[model samples]
Target: MPEPLTIMAVHAHPDDEAIGTGGILARYADEGVRTILVTCTGGELGEIADPSMATPETLGEVRERELRRACTILDVAHLELLGYRDSGMAGAEANQDPRSFAAADLDSAAGRLVELVRRHRPRVLVTYDDDGFYGHPDHIKANRITVRAFASAGDSSAYPDQGLEPWAPDKLYYTAISRSAMATFAERLSAHGINPPMSNEDGDVPPFGTPDELVTTTIDVGSAVERKRQSLWAHATQMGSNVFFARLPPPLFNELFGRESFQLVESRVATSLPEDDLLAGLRGVPGGQRHSPAR
Candidate 1:
């Protein structure tokens, strides 16, 4: 039998995996692809949304358990934690902590990810865009290191001391929320008399989503929507009952999140958009081909 296809998703915190990529992870895992999740931190600085779980001292441990439950719900084949502290929000004091993910050395952090890439030898890798989706410091740092690791993992000279042979991924994608999807969700929220989260007081859209024209791929995960919802609910301390995701009716939630979007940042194989499969043209290629890694 051929080796099973693999996909690695690098995320900034525990619950981020469920929020941003749970559908794709669940869908692909169900289709027999090996799904690996690399969480960059333990979410030590995350707010405890559950009133019962208000002990900050144990939040990291609590979140870790939540992450594990989420992985099971998503059927993730492997889970790795980079073991850094959460950096909190952009301008917060946690950003200054040397042990925080946002304050770690770029090359050093990338090196750790490179080791995972070499070991897993995934055909595709997923991570955040340059702005880190919403610009939280830890998210931005995760993007930097993931982008760097994508390139370095294929270069034999980059980290020879890591003791693994270089292995390049066939494709790299950035998780994206398309403007059209955002607009639809905003309209739905307004119809329900709830203030849309993406709109400002002036009614201008926030700098949160990618332009519709720039979205290269849209994966329809309608079949996996329930699994995705279950994964999200697993992070109880991070997502309370009043949050937008939890408040949405099941039908509406499926309508909004049933499809996921991605920007194909780097690809070794030729493929056209708007693509439905993240693997695209690389599925039948023996051992897959490597294009120049993203710089």
Candidate 2:
């Protein structure tokens, strides 16, 4: 067998990883790929969806535990928190907190992430799009830091004292979910008597090259739907065991939501849009050809 591929997923909070790429991550781990999740905050500002554990004082710790459980389910090889506090939403008071993610020390934070990149040496990195996968301020910041860190991670002169030698990732992708997917999901949910909260009147997302860019790559994770469910269940404080997703039949979900989505943001190698696989653009790089490392 070939050497195990390494993957690092950077996100602003605990459940974000699983929600965004849990199924893909599960598939990667099942195939023996080395996957890591780097969360930027403790999610102190998160709300509790589980009424049983609904205590203001206990939610943060509970969510942390839940994140660990999810990680275990996904078979993540490594996990790290950037140690920043959740910034909450854009105008929230949490955004002004000195310890909030938005207020994090940029250079130092970048160095920390860069250190991880040097240590893991993943070939592919995944993060949110320019809109930050729904325009969350913290998510946007995470994307900015990840992009910046990727640039400096491989430069020996950037942070030599941090640890391992320099190593740059070969490709970077933006996690994307298109309007078509949402419409299809809405139809699926309707079949089960679940009307979507949002409608097409909310504003349809345009195709990739037409102006409003959507995803081009569709990564199928139908086989790993159960793993993704378990991972999502791990975020108990945010999503309880009896949530809407958990209540659904796995088979139905797998058919309707068979694939995870993403946009090819930047790649040194040649690639095309509307591709069927995330690993498609990753082949034929400086070293041996490899597909998308992990989720």
Candidate 3:
């Protein structure tokens, strides 16, 4: 039998998958593509929306439960964790923890990801950019490790000690939010009399998101928005039950969360710019037939 088409995403925390990549994960899984999520941190630093639900010491485990449920909702086939704690925000005291993803040695952290790459032999790999989507320390570290694994997983000369054959994925993409999209989301939030929740945990909201011109692909995930919202709801500790996001009307929710953008950082396969499908240009898609929803 032919190998099932596979795509893998590496994220910094439990809820990260739901926010940026949830639609793709759900959409691809619906198409019978194997979806894998590698969560690098335990999300121990995430705020507990309700104190009665968990304490400081137990937040990580609670978030894991949430992560599992979110994955099920998205139909992610595999969920892997590198077992590092959330490396709070930049310059925070949590950054000092040796087990925090940001503080872990790059080679060491990335080696763990390389092993997964070789094991899964996914055709496509995805992660955040060097900015970690909003300058989160753990996000940045996830980017660093993902970039490393993407480069080394296909090279036998790298990480040979792992005893797995090297496997190269055809494409590497960075999840991104175009400046225009961010502006639209902000406008919608204002219309609802809600503040833009761009703050990085307890840290100041640094200049966030990607420039519009830099975005190379936009996947319309309108079909999967319901799953995406439910997955986000699974992380209710970070996003409240009737929070600003959940409170948005369906049209607005679809307008804001209906699409996901990506930057084609590197690719072993060819594809047209402004692609509508992440699986475009791969063997099955035949020159990347557009899978994005019709506008």
| Top candidate when judged by TM-score against the true structure | 1
Clashing pairs in 2: none
Model 1 — which ten-residue stretch has the worst lDDT? 286-295
Per-model TM-score on C-alpha atoms: 0.94, 0.84, 0.91
- Name the candidate that leads on lDDT: 1
Tens digit per residue, CA lDDT, model 2, 62-151: 777888888888888898888888899888888889988888778888888888887777777888877676667789888988888767
lDDT of 3 by residue, 141-247 (tens): 99999898887887777898999987777788999998777777776777776667764554334556898888988888989998998898898788755466767
Candidate 1 C-alpha RMSD relative to the actual structure: 2.0
Candidate 1 lDDT, 1-295, residue by residue in tens? 7757999999999989876799999999989899999999999987788669858889999999999999999999999999999999999998999999999999999999999999988888999889998889888988898888877798887899998988888789999998788888788877776666656786556756888887899899988999898898888887776676767777777777898899999877789888999989878774432434445
Task: Please report, in order, the local distance difference test score of every candidate based on alpha carbons.
Answer: 0.86, 0.74, 0.85
**Count of steric clashes across candidates, in order:** 0, 0, 2
Candidate 2 clashes: the total is 0
Task: Please rank every candidate by lDDT, starting with the best.
Answer: 1, 3, 2
The 10 consecutive residues of candidate 2 with the worst lDDT sum are: 203-212
Worst 10 residues of 3 by lDDT: 286-295
Better of 2 and 3 by lDDT: 3
